[model samples]
Target: MSKIIDTAHVFFFVVGLEVRQEFAHGALRDTSRARLAVIAGVASVALPALVYVLVVGAAGAEGIEGWGAVVGTDTAFMLGALAIVGPRLSGQLRVFLLTLTVVDDFLAVSIIGIFYSEEIRIVPLLVALACLLALWLLGRSRQWSAAPYVLIVLGLWLATLSSGVHASLAGMIAGLLIPAYPTRRHKVVAARQLFRDFWQSPSASSARAVGRGLSRGVSVNERLHEYLRLPTALLAVPIFALANAGVDLRGGLLVDSLGSPVTWGVVAGLVLGKLLGIGLATLLAVRLGAGRLPEGVGMGSVFGGAALSGIGFTVSLLIIGLAFGTTSDLGRQATLGVFVAMVLACVLGWAIFKVAARRWGEETADLPMTLEPPVDPEVDHIRGPEDAQLTLVEFVDFECPFCAHATGSWEDLHERFGDDLRYVVRHLPHHPHGPIAARAAEAAANQGMFWPWLDFVFTRQHALERDNLVDYAVELGLDVETFTEDLDSAEVAKRVERDAASAADSGAHATPTFFVEGCRLLGSYDARTLTAMLESSRRGTRTQEIPA
Candidate 1:
């Protein structure tokens, strides 16, 4: 099973490489091409997402049992592959593909949060917001060390995971915020000299010239670029695949599960929807004057690549895990769907690329120059000892399904424990709502109605857009004028940033993370598990009071 998972990882890497190469070639030459690719990716993602929203919402499965089968594209596995392959093909093409993939990731994350999530915990969301601010602020002037920023990034992932947002959303958010340019003058000088050499002698030695440019002096931003392009993409993604994709398929049960409606839905959505969405969107982009044909590539090649977008492996599988419980028929079906889609995508994508390569002669272009920006660390605040005892620490995001679950659980705790529990909220913003949601949470906190606002979020986690957050504040009878302004205020942003940093330092990478009396738990929990822990903590507290 592990071997099969590993093979699947390699398979995805290849698929990602092919798709990226296609996008990169298009992106460098024409902005329209990149835009089209983005459109196709989003269109493909929307197919499943829409299905989830409509079917699940109508069925009232918006609760824990229902939203378990929502499917999404795995951006990291796909885009990370592009990053690893580097801009070696055509620089313009690579840029186009990279940008498209980045946008794809961002959109997918947003959909998960805004439409699919459950509830928000104000404190955790605030914490996540603070972290985002810190990352932006510390890295804003581009004066921070890469180590602290890296730690901050990881911490955000952990806290976001704990907070109830998809942990992967943290990865994307952090990636976007982390600068990717030369920070030092010496590095810039060396890079320019190397670029000059490449332009001067195109035929002399491309590989050596590029290597020299990459090896130029160290910049925190450049190092970050390397981290994203290399370890995160090539190593972490593949390892994650090996861990997550291995399913025991030998059982006849596995085969039978694939025949179910849920499986069909996932498979059809990924396979059929991807092709239709991507292909149609590409055509529309061209018609709308948003995209154009690449110099050598034609509509046929685009269609073929569009078909490849059908390969919804990682993200699809993850959604399956969340939308469908692991033990259910839905999960089994989703797993099969992912495998079928990947296989189909790989074959079709390869065929299309082969034809395009032969016909167009595969002539590549060079990468465009990118200006380096300053990088920062989004860190959480340190907790005091008194705040530690009986402290209910929750790291969460406003837009996260699991966070919603945690929010539900926390509400239960707050009701049951009442004043006994001192809640400490931390931000672990993930995906579409990370930064935006955090800001909203902070704004609500400013009005002294943070708890009620959190309850409102839990009730409408799926509706955490900027407008929705503002509306929520209004519904809560807050000073809408002040609340709206606070949502974007630097002070609020900073407070959220502080909490986010605290979450990172605490090693949270998933949404709805909890530390009850120093015991940590990740992901959502049932009432029984949480009650048991609370009971245990209560017992311990009582025993300590007995003066042992």
Candidate 2:
């Protein structure tokens, strides 16, 4: 009973992510790509239902049909398989696989809501909808903090749980409604606008003396790539794994259910069906000219990815909970299948991928070439002292809200350590407002006002328009004559271009990518994690300095 409840809760959490990623990913503006993405998402839900029907048909009416209709593979099981494959596939192949899996998940969850659900309590669902509406309004108004979102999301989840809907739906609905990172953008805009106003105003003194005291007021996608990559890489997915992976063997009946037909069906579906489905689909797509083959991924690697797809731990557990009710023999059988399939798939996939990758030649993506348009005067020669004790390399987009947050974090670190840290900020302008912002940062750097401008941007990060960048430079007491000229200078453009290429080379698929010393720092780190890494680095430096 407890396990069923736990599994349901985990399912709800993932559903929330699915919803958020679906709606927010492209729904606001409603582009053709966005519409297609949603359609693809909705269509994918059939995989689980088909599996359920097949199993039930095989069992006949005498066998149990379970409670809720859902029957799906586990997410933890799939990811565990991928982990075993290691870096055998090229980055592109890995990304493609990740996305397809997410789409498959989206489909499975939709099946749960549309087919398996027993009741429709409109009031609670409406109430949940209202909460999301309120959050959306706040986010649009540029209230970009994650605090209120966190609190309200909890309430909504509980409400959904009590309202007879799956609680994970709460997560999906709420995540979509909450803004990704708004506060930082609001700050950037406010800061740049303030600086702009100061710049245009007539200066009674030299440009150096003009408005140095100005204060700050405030602050997707190539979806296929991120869609495939983020779900597994993100913390939310991992959290789901930890929560859903536990299966207590203390119960005797569950242990005995391994002999059941339902158990065999689920295990076979994941271990066999996933491999066939994914591998067949991929091969067909390539053969029919729907998609090209990714580099360095051999037939063996493809098979490995397919094999790992059978590790259906998280999603399969959810289906089991919905299908078998609590503490039943069927549920126990399903659980066993999930555990065994995941382990077997992971081990087998890893061996195959490793062997194939070794045979195929280790070629990487041409990241630098694909990142940005070419330029005459390359800025790749801006090298820092190689012998520095500590290096903090950051890839930022001046217009990015997270970049503003990162800028503040960088400043705090610099203030704390002073000369002990050598900070290098690189440009990574992504779509729309990105290039404009990069130009602004580069212009500021030319006049030695880069730090000040960066502080203002972080303080108020949203107003990074092309015009705003120039105006902010003028407001920062930079010589307008020099700054304006430099803004259009080939050198400035080249610098940003070089930064973009370097960011690509460093394995940065998104903005705010950070490297401390040499190792890549994964995900969003708070101050404490950064401090810990820094402290650890210091200890290492001391050890090296000792003549060992």
Instruction: Indicate which candidate wins on lDDT.
Output: 1
Predict model 2's lDDT versus the native: 0.55
Over the stretch 1-548, how does candidate 2's per-residue lDDT look in tens digits? Answer: 33433444444444444434433431223243233323322323344335645765676732245422233444444544565445522444444444455566656655566755667688887877777777677667655344565566666765666566655445444545544422334445555565566678745553333232221121111222234344434554556666665666666756465666666566566666666666665665556655544433445666677677666665566667776753666677667767776777677767766666677633331122122222112332122343446766667776566662544576567666667766667778885777867777777777767767776776555566666766776677888778777778898899788777677666565677766655556645555566667767877841111100
Error of 2 at 529 (Å): 7.5
Candidate 1 Cα misplacement greater than 4 A, ranges: 1-34, 48-71, 76-95, 115-120, 182-219, 249-251, 292-298, 358-548
lDDT for predicted candidate 1 compared with the true structure = 0.56
lDDT of 1 by residue, 489-528 (tens): 9999888777666555554545666665544543335555
Candidate 1 clashes: the total is 63
Taking all chains together, the TM-score of candidate 1 against the true structure is 0.50
Residue 253, model 1: lDDT of: 58
